[model samples]
Target: MAFFTKEQAKAAARRSENMLDQVAGLESYSDERFDVFLSHSMLDQDLVVGVAMLLKEQGYSVYIDWVEDEELDREHVDKETAERLRQRMRNCSSLIYIATDRSGQSKWMPWELGYFDGYKDGGVAILPLVDTVNSGFDGQEYLGLYPLVNQVNQRLYVEDASKVHSDFWAFVNDPSR
Candidate 1:
């Protein structure tokens, strides 16, 4: 019943510094089934990588653009990049929006959320990483429409406050969910 916070994410980053040993790059969209297409700000590269590793430890295949597609050039905005992301999103069962102070600045996060929301019919959750559990994602827009992802003993869960809270694993495992 604990919220996922920035401190925990940072710890994960420290827990394992290198991802090359963990996830194999060049993950084929057609060959792989990803549990979450991590929608995040490229500015927070380390944080996102940590989150991906954390999720992988929980037995989920995560699709991170730069990780999977190393050829992806974030600096160069192109229609193909969007299309590639679209294809990855299609292969994922859910999308986790890594909400932080830098999250609002990402051009792809909103589009990823919107596309996944429409494509998966609301298969998106915001993993709001704040400085403290008591703090929240303030001034961020359009994030409340979906559930929130949190951690408990390193396990992931999704919950819509005042509604329902369930395991992140269960959500991905359940087809009707």
Candidate 2:
């Protein structure tokens, strides 16, 4: 499957900002249950916004920390912040770890992935971003263990080494999972 390139994602992000009320993270508040709990490095804010836009366009509701939790500070971690994040994670049906060049440096992405995988079971996937469209993911070692999110013809799918690309929803809700 073709992956999203950084340039394409940025363009999509700009379009999302101009077409909607705002960019993915700056959009109006959402109090409803989220389809995805997006886990990514704050350093990839622009990329995250773009990725969220793609998800939103595909009819998925995404939960972004900066957009939903303005009170929490990443630099100064506290019990309240962790607790609040956990609570939010519970409200989301699935988690999408956006694996970028900076993902390995993040402190929360791995924890969020593990937490969602354990508590929700089969509700976790990785969306890898590359410098070019045909390029592949080269993130942390363990990231390959989970299904990798992919986009083809603007539709999302998840694939692992042992299986072909599966429907995004079906992959997350697989009964065998």
Candidate 3:
């Protein structure tokens, strides 16, 4: 549950804002099946919901498993449920793994990430939502070679809400970076 220093958060926010400005023109090109599939631990529902809402507000199609379907029993995911989850992953252009403390321990998050990587041939962007407002993240190494949205040195992670819009759109439009 360690948090970023105020100064570090501010710097990250500024970087986010700059990135947004640079990628402002990319909105027109980002028309994918699903803009993002938000993968997170069930324990961090509220935070993930907020992030999904923000993305949706920016006109990005976000797929959050529990929110999109009421039939999913979080406590008991059966074979059918697993297949449905894989289907959703296939439909997404990007996967945003909410890299929080709880997510690190979740059995499904890593599996989903692996599935996406294999299905998309590493073409789809796999971004980590680090430095979240509520939860702390394990070190960047925990992401295990995946590109991250909120790493300390990376240009994508931003604390400012408005900046996130630009950063995300930019990432989706050009996942190769």
- lDDT scores for all predictions? 0.79, 0.80, 0.59
Model 3, range 1-177, lDDT digits (tens) per residue? 223333343444444444333433332222326778888888876556555544554577777776555557878889988888888777787787766556767889888878887887543433434454455544446365554454333234432223332354666655562
Q: TM-score order of candidates, best first?
A: 1, 2, 3
TM-score of structure candidate 2: 0.88
Error of 1 at 53 (Å): 1.8
Give the alpha carbon lDDT tens digit for every residue of 57-123 in model 2: 8788778888777656877999888887888887888899988898889999998998888888878
TM-scores for all candidates: the values are 0.90, 0.88, 0.63
For model 3, give the 10-residue run with minimal summed lDDT. 23-32
TM-score, structure 1 vs. true: 0.90
Q: Which candidate comes out best when scored by lDDT?
A: 2
Better candidate by TM-score, 1 or 2: 1
TM-score of 3: 0.63
Candidate 1 lDDT over residue span 12-128, tens digit each: 888877775556565465657788889999889878877887887778888888778887787887999888888888889998889888998888788888988898875888887
| Deviation (Å) of 3 in candidate 3 | 11
Model 3 misplaced regions, further than 4 Å:
1-32, 123-142, 151-167, 174-177
Question: Candidate 1: lDDT of 25?
Answer: 65
